[model samples]
Target chain A: MRLRCLALILFSLSSSLARTQPDIANPHSEDTNWLNQYAHGLGEQHTELGLEALQLGDYAKAERSLLDAIQVIKVNQGLYATDQLRPLQYLIEAQLTLGEWHAAETQIEYFQWINVRNYRNSIFTYLNGTEALSGLLLASSANVNNPYSVRHLVAAKNLNWQAVNAIEQTFGSNSLELAPWLYRIVLNHYYQSTMLRRQGLSNYSFKSDSSEIVSGWTMRHNETLEMSYRIGKELLGRIQELFAYHVADHEQISNDATALMTIYQGDWELLFGNDEEALEHYRSAYQDLLQMGRSEAQVDRFFDRPVSLPAPRLQMQWPDQLAAESNEPLQFFAWSPMYPSASRPAEPRGDALAADDQQTALARFDLTPAAEDEPADTILADTNLSLDNLQILGTTPDNELTREQARVYISLLQFRPRLVSGMPVKLENIELEYLFPPQMSLLPLLDP
Target chain B: MIRSVGAYLKIRGTEMFKAIFALLSILLLHACVGSPAQSNAPRLPTDAEVEQYNASVPADEHIVCRDEIPVGTNIPRRKCRYVRDIQQTSTFHREQLRRALQ
Candidate 1:
C-alpha cells in the first residue's frame, strides 16, 4: 500500500513538472505543411525522405524528416540507444553548416543526455565526448530555443560542462576520454570571458611546445591559469600514454624525485616532489645542526607528507634552457661529501660476493656529488672523524674498522651555494633549495 | 474462462494503442522545433568521390576543410587553441626553475 502511494505521488510530481515547464516555442516554422507531414510517415520512410530532401538541397524539408526520424528512433530504440545517435549526428552537421552554434550545442547536449542515461543503465561505458565538444560554441549568438526537453538546460549555457560531467559520470574521471573535454572546457571559459569581448579579442595564437602547428585562442577572461592547466593536461596525457607502454622508460626519464624533464599526468607536483621535498636540503641542514649542536626540541619543527614543490610556476613556465648551451661558467657554493684519495680510500668491507642488481639500483639515486678536477688541492679533513671516536669503535684484528660500527658512507652530500657571490664560489652553508644531486665523484676525500 | 481471456486481450490492445499514440505525439512535437537547416547536404559520399577529391590535393600535409568533408562523416573543427605549448616553452620552464633555485 505504501509503495503504491509513493509511485502515485512520483507520477503526479513528474506530470506537474511537465505541465509547469514551458514548451519552448518551436524555432522552425510550424505553419509549413511539409513538417506536418512528418506525423504521418514511418521512421524509415521519413529517413528516406530526409536523405532525398537533403540531396535535393531542400534543407527545410530535410530537417523536418530528419527531426521526426530522430524523435521516432528515440521513442523506439530508447533515448540514448547507439542507433538513436545517427540522425542527431546528421542534424548537428546541418546546424554547423548553417552557423547555428546554439542549436548545434543543444543537439550535442541531447546526445550527451541520452548517452549519459544509457551509460548509467549498464550500457556501453566509455562514450567518447571529445569529438562532440570540438566544434561546439562557434555561433556568435547565444540566443536559441531548447528543442529537446533537457532538464535545467538553457541553450549553450554550460553545454561543455554538461558534456564533460556526463562523460565523467559514465567513465571514471581519470579516463583519457577526459583529455579533450578538459581542453574544450578551458577553451569555452576563454570564449565566455567578458574581458576578451571588451578588448575585441581576435586571433591570439601560439604553438604548443609539443605540437608543430599553431592554434588561435581568444581570452574570455584575463588569466594564464586556464592555459597552464591545458598544458598540464597535455603533460598528463603524455605521461599516461608513456607509462602504459613503458614504465621502465618513464622511471628512467623521470629520474626519481626531481625530474628536470617531467611528464606528470596529475599536475606539476609530480615533476618535483611536494614543496617540502624542494626544501629538503634546508631540513637536512637543520637536522645535521641538531646532531652537531642544536637542541632536540627543534627537531619536530619541520616534517610533512602532503607537500607541494615550490617551483610549480617554474615548471609551468620553464627557464631559458639555451643557457646550458652557452659557454658561461656559472658559480656554485658546494659543501658535500668528498671521495677519499686512493691510499686514504675508506675500507671496502661489504661482502663482495653479495653484489646484486638491487645494490646497483640503490647506488643510482645516492646523493653523492662527483669530485671535481681540483680535488687534489681541496684535500680536507673529515669533520666528523675523531681519534677518540675511532677508538670507541676499535678496529678488527687486521687494524680495519668493521662495516657494522664504522660505515664508509660513499658520499652523503648536500650542495649549497653562497647566494651573495655571483659565480666561481663553492658551497658554504646549507639552505632550503633543490639541486640535481650529483653522482658519486671519481676522486675520494683525503685526511689532512 | 472465455470472459477472462477476452479481458486480458483487451488490456494488451489498449497498451499497444497508448504506446503508438505517445510515440506519434512526441514525433509531432519534436518535428516542429528544429532550429537550423543546411541548404545543400550531399548524399553519403562514395569511395570514388572521396578518392577523386584526394588525388587533386597539392601539399604533402594539408588541413582538410568542412566543405571538402562528407556530411555523413565527422571531422571536428580544425581550429584548436590549447595554449601553453610545452614543447616550445618547456625549455624556458626548465631554465627558469634552475635559475630561481640557483
Candidate 2:
C-alpha cells in the first residue's frame, strides 16, 4: 500500500512537473518572482518526504514537510489551486496533532475558502462554512462534469468531517456522541446522492481524487441507498451496545433510535421494492409512537402535522436532579412511516374502523363545511386524519373534491409535480408537533 | 452313506460357524458405514411441489405429511417427499398437520 501511494504521488508529480518542468529549469527570464523560480520540484520533494515521515511516525517532520509542500504548491500553482489542498490537509493534521492551533487555523481558513471559492451566491449555498477540513471535504465536491458550477459537496462534507473531528478530538472517537455523528455523516452523503439524483445528474464524487473511496461516487440511486443503508445498519447496531439496556426509561431516545433504524430499514426496503419490509418498518414505527404513549388517533395526528424538524434528536429522560443537563427536550418522529403509510387498526376490530375511514374519505374533499370553521382546504387539518384517510392531493380523484380545494391541490402539485403525474408521492421529514393540534395537550397519552 | 456324511458334518461344524460369523460382520459393516441414503440424500419439496401436493390431495382426506407424499402410490411417481412450506415455516404448518392427525 505504501509503495502504491508512493507510485501515485510520483505519477502525480511527474504529470504536474511535465506541465511546469520547463518553467522550473529556465525560470522564464521575464518572471520577476525569485520564490516561484526556486520553488521548482519543492512541492514534490516535500510531499515525498512528508509521506515517508508520516509512515515513520515522525509527525513533526511530516508536518514540516507537508507545510513546505503546501506552500510550494501554492506558489507554483495558484493559492486556491486544487493541488495545494492535499498538502494543506496533511499540514493541518500535523499542526493539529502538534497542538499548533495558530498554524492549523490559517491552513483551515484557506482550505475552507478554496473549497467554496469564496462564492457568496445562491448556487454556492452548499459551499458555506470555514473549516480547513471543508477544503478536504470539497475536494470531492467538484461537479467534475461541470468545472464552473458550484455543486459544492466539498464544503458541506468538510463541515461534517470537521464536526466529527471536533467531537472526536474533544470527546474521543469512542464517545457515544461519535455514533450519532457517524450516522449524520451517512445521512449527509445520502442527502447529496438524493440531490444529485433529483437533478438527473448521474456523475458525482463524494471524495477528492486523492482520497477516493472504494465505492466510487457515481450518484447511483440503488448503490447510494444501499451503501448508506449498510453503513447505517452497521453503525446502529454498534450504537445499541452503548444504550440498549438502559434505554427503557428514556422512552423518547429509545423510540427515536428505534424509529431511525426502522426508517432506514424501511426506506431501503421501499427503494428496492420490498413492500413487506417497508410495511414492517411502518408497523414498527407505529408501535414506537404508541410506546411513546401516543394513541392511534394521536399517532395519526402526529404524522398529519405539517411542521418540519430541522434535525433529528430525542430528549433523554434524566432524573429530576440531573434534569438541568437536558434543557431542550426533543421528541423525534420517524418520517418514512407517515407517507406511503400502512395503518394497522388502532383497535383490532375491523369493519367499523374501515367504515369510519370511508366516511372520512367521503367528507375529505367535500367543500361543504361540517361547521362554520371547516374549509375544503382544511380537510386534512383534523386530528382524526388516520393513516387510511391520508389523502394527499392527486392520490385520489377529484370527483369528490370541490373546486374550493384547488388551493391546497395546486400547492402540492408545485411541491412535487409527480403528485399529478399519478406517480407515488413520497412525504418526508414530517414533524411530530404538527400531527396533534396543541389543543390535544389536555388529553392523556393513551396506551394499548 | 449317512454315517460318512455325519462324520464329515462333525469335522466341518467349526468351519461352518466361523464362516457364518464372518458373513454377519460384513453385513453389519455395510449397513453402518456405507448406506446408500448418505449419498442419495432425500431432497426437499419446493413451494410449487407443496402446492401441487395440496391440490392433488382430496380436501376431505387431509394431505399426507411431507415425508409420505408419493410414497404409497404403486406407480412410484417422483414427487418432493420433503414438504417445503407454502405460506410460512414448515414447522408451523406441521403443527396444523399434528392437530389434524390428533
Choose the strongest candidate by lDDT. Answer: 2
**Tens-digit per-residue lDDT, B1-90, candidate 1:** 899999999999999999999999998766544322422333433222222232233222222222223367453322221134433355
Give the runs in model 2 whose Cα sits over 4 Å from its true position: A1-151, A158-174, A195-225, A232-275, A291-297, A306-448, B1-102
DockQ-based CAPRI category assigned to the predicted complex of candidate 1: incorrect
In terms of DockQ, the best-performing candidate is 2
Model 2 — interface RMS deviation? 24.6
Those runs of model 1 whose alpha carbons end farther than 4 Å from true positions after fitting are: A1-45, A48-58, A74-82, A99-109, A122-126, A133-174, A180-221, A224-448, B1-102
Residue A162 C-alpha lDDT in model 2 = 46
TM-score of chain B of 2: 0.31
Task: Tell me which residue pairs clash in candidate 2.
Answer: A108-A132, A137-A154, A138-A154, A301-A435, A302-A435, A305-A434, A305-A435
- In candidate 2 chain A, what residue range of length 10 has the lowest lDDT sum? A413-422
C-alpha lDDT of residue A268 in model 1: 36
